[model samples]
Target: STSSPSSSSTSVETPVETLKSYLSELLNNHNAKRALHGVSDLVWDEEVYQYAKSFADAYSCPADGMLSHSDGSYGENLAAGFSSAASVVDAWYEEIQYYNFNNPGFSMATGHFTQLVWASTDKLGCAYKDCNTIYGRYVVCNYSPPGNVIGHFAANV
Candidate 1:
């Protein structure tokens, strides 16, 4: 006896069909300018990064940066590094792991910090002021369609 016709139909998804699967939500376009409320323009400049690294290496918490006995440990060294970095900028934080010895990035550089201040009384956290320095941290932003897209298009036309 012959078996029933084997299933031969196969489903082929098309790009358009796949595209339809993607549901997009229009995130209300809060004016980027408005969203940038109280945004600090601090950026990581090469000079700043270099200076920061040097200062940190030159000075840092001793106990963390170096090994010593209970008397005058690397804590002093760590503090020194932070102090040096802070001298350049208004504020700085020290970051130190094992094997100190003037480790860079142990100190927080205000130059690399950014603060997004909303209209509310609350103050948003400070972003790395120098995140975008040529040799510094990375900075990211959520971009939206240009506010004057139509104007740009019209100009092109």
Candidate 2:
């Protein structure tokens, strides 16, 4: 007639309680606190979330007046489909420059930059000067160019 320990009631942790517990543990640990020194508070702030949402809505892909294809494509080809790969590379360079000027702090990985160069070379059947120029810029930046220029280049290429 006695209830076993397995039958005892248990409390489910709410989201807030779980987050508080995690934060408490993180705060108590010196290493975790040090690692999260600058961003700990922003992690849970509602205002930060709102600001991020606003920025995303404002600047995300499919910018104002841009069309989207039924198949989910952006419907705007960076360089015309029939254009040669060299032309594409040139377009990408100009695009990257524009992005760098517009956005203060963004960078692209060297691996990706090299991949784009190789892809352009493959498509063009020869290496182009744009490849060396873009790659050199990437090297000068230690393989990460400021701004989302690389992203723009990749998309266009």
Candidate 3:
């Protein structure tokens, strides 16, 4: 392996864009779909759907954007990619914090991850939380087994 670790900023930006562009494309199809089974497509609520859509739109990118899609089944490949990229970025954020705090006079860290967590599920349409750090920062992450493991290890390491 190359001794020099890849810069997280380079990796993080693409996912943010991929997610934003994908969502922006999906939202273009404005017809509301039923929130529940057998509820009838006729019962689709425009206000509710648009509200969720707008929430996704206005929310910050990369960090919180991935959380919004946490609940859904994101197929295999895409989910894997998301998990890997997030792990890398989260680790980078923490490392920067440690380096900055320890090397106070010589080092300064800028660029903060936004504080917004949104996890949607069958029971919960969109659960929102904040991933903020008093001394550092956090990205809102969907709590899944292997995926979450990557996050936990990154933080701990």
Candidate 4:
């Protein structure tokens, strides 16, 4: 397998076109699901994109093939193994099955879905790496006014 990893979606690192492509792809998939659930659509933010890019770049895929998260103030959703941007979003959204609207709270299995469709989270930015490591590839999305706060998932998600 190839080990020449590549990255994009930042002003300094890639073309504006690359940024726009992912911005459209990630937003379209995310908003479509959020809309179906009665939440406002999310807008792309460059700063948030940078946040995701930083994490994707700094950590990358390791030999152990495990994923790690950057525990910052923002909310994040991490995914891997998928080859397309939309597929990544779908995988995150697929967690909706585990979310209990009746109970409405944080859950390890459902956090990604909740974060994806979280109502108050209006801004989003995502980045990924074509890592040739054991893990291959991974996607990272950072949300502003992050969701999944304890006791608030009932209202926010």
lDDT (tens digit, per residue) of candidate 3 on 1-157? 5454343221222355665544333222111221211221121234333444344334443543343333333100111122333442343244334443232222223211111110121111111112221211212222111122222322321
Where does candidate 4 clash, by residue pair?
none
Candidate order by lDDT, highest to lowest? 4, 3, 2, 1
The clash tally of candidate 4 reads 0
Candidates, ranked, TM-score: 4, 1, 3, 2
RMSD, every candidate, angstroms? 23.3, 21.7, 18.2, 4.7
Off by over 4 Å in 4: 1-19
lDDT, residue 98, candidate 3: 40
lDDT, candidate 1, 1-157, per-residue tens: 5553333212122364432221010011112222433322222234333433344333223233342222211111111122122231222111112212333222223111111111221111111122111223211111111111222222211
In order, the Cα lDDT scores of the candidates are 0.22, 0.26, 0.26, 0.82
Query: In candidate 4, what are the lDDT values of residues 2-61, reduced to their tens digit?
Result: 442333321124467976786688888999999988999999899998999888887646
Q: Pick the candidate with the highest TM-score.
A: 4
Residue 139 shift from truth in candidate 3, angstroms: 18
Clashing pairs in 2: 106-147
lDDT of 2 by residue, 65-143 (tens): 2322122111111212212433334343333333333433334322222323222121111111111111211100110
Give all TM-scores, in the order shown: 0.20, 0.19, 0.20, 0.85
Candidate 4 similarity to native, TM-score: 0.85
What does the lDDT come to for candidate 2?
Answer: 0.26
What root-mean-square deviation over C-alphas does model 4 reach? Answer: 4.7
Q: For residue 65, what is the lDDT in candidate 3?
A: 31
